[model samples]
Target: MKKPVAGDSPASSLSPCEIPKSLLPIFLKHIAAFIDSLNVVVLARLLPQSHHRRILTASTSAVAASLLSQRQHRLVLAISTPLLQPPAASTRPLLPPDNGIKKNVQGPTFMRKIWARDKQEAIQVEFNDLGQPIDEKSSSELAHFLGAIARNGRYAPLHYKNWIKVPQTYKKEMLTQVQEKFQLPPGQEDWILKSITKKWRNWKSFVKTNYYDPNVSLVEQMKNVPERVHEDQWKELVTFWNSDASKRVSDRNKVSRGHQKMVHRKGKMSFARVAEKKKKELGYYPSRSTLFIECYSKGETPGNEVASQAMVQNRVCLKSINDPTQIVAKGIVRSIDPSTEVGGSRLRPNWCEVHIQVAVEWDEELIRRYGMFETIGDALGAHVAWPLFLVERDESDD
Candidate 1:
């Protein structure tokens, strides 16, 4: 006998019609039951009505008979329910239908283009051979130059671990670059250098605060280096930041900051801006005390006890100086220039003490010539004040 091949298996040889008569009904019933068990409603909802009808029409006679007998009610319900009910109202708002041609949308890119154009127009400046702008006094031009230097690899001051430790050559080079870009006055170079140093220190502090986590490993922290900083520099910084020395120094500085009593609420507004505003409002520049009160206090009272006490003392001193009984000789000198006096510039008007001898004879000629003072220290030049006590001592009776 020939060996049975793979396709000659008993099950594979049996066709649908070749199955035993008794089991044929059972097989068809099982197949029909399986079709009925399926989520036909979901399928009917997803498919078009024509396709759903075609599926039912294509079924074998035996299976169809079984389906009609067992699931006739279900088939009618599934098919009719979808047709009877309208589709759920879409929650989303209707957008304008898309055309074949794509239109250019005014999004971030368009806004960026507008901003770039505005910035270019706003910061227009003529550059010299050294690439410095002609308009040195223009703050916008100066800001542009500074921004360029910050991005340039040649300016190494910004990358230094410690600004104080940065070499003088690097600082001089940066100053020279700034000078070449703008015509800086003689003493203004120092101011520029100081400003740059402050910016660098602030940037480093920002990096330490945001990126340097004490709990994280140095290598891991270095991975999160700021885009402006070099990887090697950031690695070194992270290593240093992780050191005990850095932590100790940071803790000490934090403690020192905590001890500070009088903090200003002026925010980013500088004293110069405050003075300018006050000058505009009052028709003259405000005194340092007035500026202090404006910066550190709300209304007339100061924020802290120390500042409040100082303000009170200041008022008392001013009142006493203005009193006729406390008046002594005036116009003894043509003018008192605080800048010319030794350590005179350091004195504050409110802190000064004045000892008056009410019993002693006043200088009649001096008092008559000067007349009553309009304001305390008004006789003195602008920004000048008597910060010391004037005690009258008589040598005739002694």
Candidate 2:
């Protein structure tokens, strides 16, 4: 059927229906809603026809949550409600745009979006402009300190499998306080602060063990420190420096994660007694470790007795870590060097303390080295390498 077209005139150039410019917003909103394919309701009444949005996308945003910014509210709604409709039958896998994308945003990542929006939003905040770089000595000192830290074995995060967050034992900006107090000019202040931070880092690394050592007294640092204006401030410093509650929390989380990895379906029941388990509560303690060993001959078979005794010997080696593991005195036969003899007993055996006087060879100059027994046990389980008899000296025999 032939239909009559509009006559050639100014009216004809215009769209015949002429969806009004005034109505464009209303129509476009409906279109977006249709494209989104969500249940949308159009409100015609509230703010007169001029300002009214056609389709109010049903938001899950709560009233209180929207106080921060409308964008947050929008994001909550956008995420909570799936925007894309499922493919009818067969299509590419449904994915939100940019599911796995890296963003190199400056400032805080969490606040990046907000800042982008409210860059013009006026608010006053004070910031001490950073001091400029000063003499090369400061820079050199800082560099040296940082390098030393990297070389230090004490702060070995490598020892831990997880990203053990080395507690911020030394603050980078703390030196700024001293610098500022001394009224050193900007350049010098920067240099000094930088230097102090470097020194702190270097010291941490050289120690070979973390600041979390039980024997290292944090409170003692306070004793050496000069008289301070506020004692409370000193206490706070000591509290954090001495006890790395943050790192401890992190270590626990790492252990928890490791434990979560082993989900037993239905597994072996232990024959080891509850008391034994309680007594030697092995594994998953703070910085705790498990060592399993089978020892006989280095090249051939080490007898069961030898392996069994190795467990006790293993305990001795771990003890050295508590002190220093340079020596192993366990199970050595040597003559008493002392001229004086005991009145009651005539024997001073050359045997050293398993932990103390050393007869066994140990090579611990740099990297951690364990005793022969401890090393073997760390490799083999006690059940596999246990000795039948680990004899103790009888008083009667003595």
Candidate 3:
């Protein structure tokens, strides 16, 4: 007769098949070894082909040895009869069937930890002498602060063109609140005030566009006013909207908007964010020309005729400039003082005094480079052709 497997023993007359307590430890050890060897073989398959042969051989040997040892001890017991038999109803306790829902006992602890971490990070943020945070989080926080002020009805009717027209007491209160919350330096008071004023104006415009309807009567429009705004303030806003002066201003703005040739396709993305994204992609901050092209162009082509001409002119200007750094320095100075004349008759205010000096300098340069011009205006107009080059020259000397 064929020999039975070591684990396949005849039924004992005394009791059910149970491993001896003394041999239980040894049985578990062998089972663990067998599992570990199988895991090793699985891992071996993932290794390089050269290492696989050696690793698999060692694991297979271990598996075979563990099986042999287990068989000798009859540790791989098959208690098939017990597995097939059902437990007595009285022996097993009655319990409800499990569904997948679980209680979130650790939720409060997790939220507290998150809050603490955010608080710690906020404390660690650094700021410049100007009170501007060096980190991006502070920018987001400032935006949130401005948004809160914008949403508050107490600071409504931001119709004044100049920030100076706002009440002094209100400005002081806002300044004090900003200083307390953001730790703003005294130097940044003007900047903070301007930012707040701009936000308020924008919020006012948003409310007017989204809530007010000119077709509806003043009373009907008043009903649509935001709950945060007082009824009196809403009536004043409606009165302003219906005024002849406001209508004239609106018509002028529509005319000015129609003259705009280039549309900003970059949407709401700031130039800073665009530069940052480009830096990540290209592994460095892009040059002004590269940034302009990337931002204003679609793929290889310029977005519009104006952008196309600007790029062509920029290339010409880059060639004309002997020292590129001068261009950057002059650009910075021009930005700080928009009244600074830059070799163009753009009819800017405060340009008369600066323009005379600029014209004289350009006249000499134009004569030396491109022969004589008919008049100072002719020389200045010629300078505009190389707009990027002549604009950088220092004409600060009176």
How do the predictions measure up, each by TM-score?
0.42, 0.18, 0.43
Per-residue alpha-carbon lDDT of candidate 3 for residues 123-207, written as tens digits (9 for 90 to 100): 2334454454444565556655755564455553454443576678777776655555554444777766766777777677766
Clashes of each: 1, 16, 0
Off by over 4 Å in 1: 1-154, 157-161, 298-398
Q: Supply the global lDDT for candidate 2.
A: 0.32
CA error at residue 302 for candidate 3, angstroms: 2.6
Q: Alpha carbon lDDT of residue 24, candidate 2?
A: 91
**Per-residue alpha-carbon lDDT of candidate 2 for residues 102-205, written as tens digits (9 for 90 to 100):** 55433211222222333244222211234433233443333333333333233322222222343344333343323322334434444444544444443433
Residue 108 Cα positional deviation in candidate 2, in Å, after optimal superposition: 15
Compose the digit string of candidate 1's lDDT tens values, residues 1-398: 34557869876665677678999889988876565535354445544453467446634322222222123434554554322222122111112335766765432111222123332244334433333333434644465455445434357544455767888888788777666555444556655666566656665776666556788776567666554456677778888777789889999999997855555667745455566667689998676656665665544233553333332113222112233235333221112222243223333322222222231223222211123433333333322233222211122323
Q: What C-alpha lDDT values do all the predictions have?
A: 0.47, 0.32, 0.46
TM-score for candidate 2, residues paired by index: 0.18
TM-score of candidate 1 on Cα atoms, chains taken together = 0.42
After superposing candidate 3 on the true structure, give the runs of residues whose Cα lies further than 4 Å from its correct spot.
1-134, 156-162, 262-300, 303-305, 308-398
Worst 10 residues of 2 by lDDT: 288-297
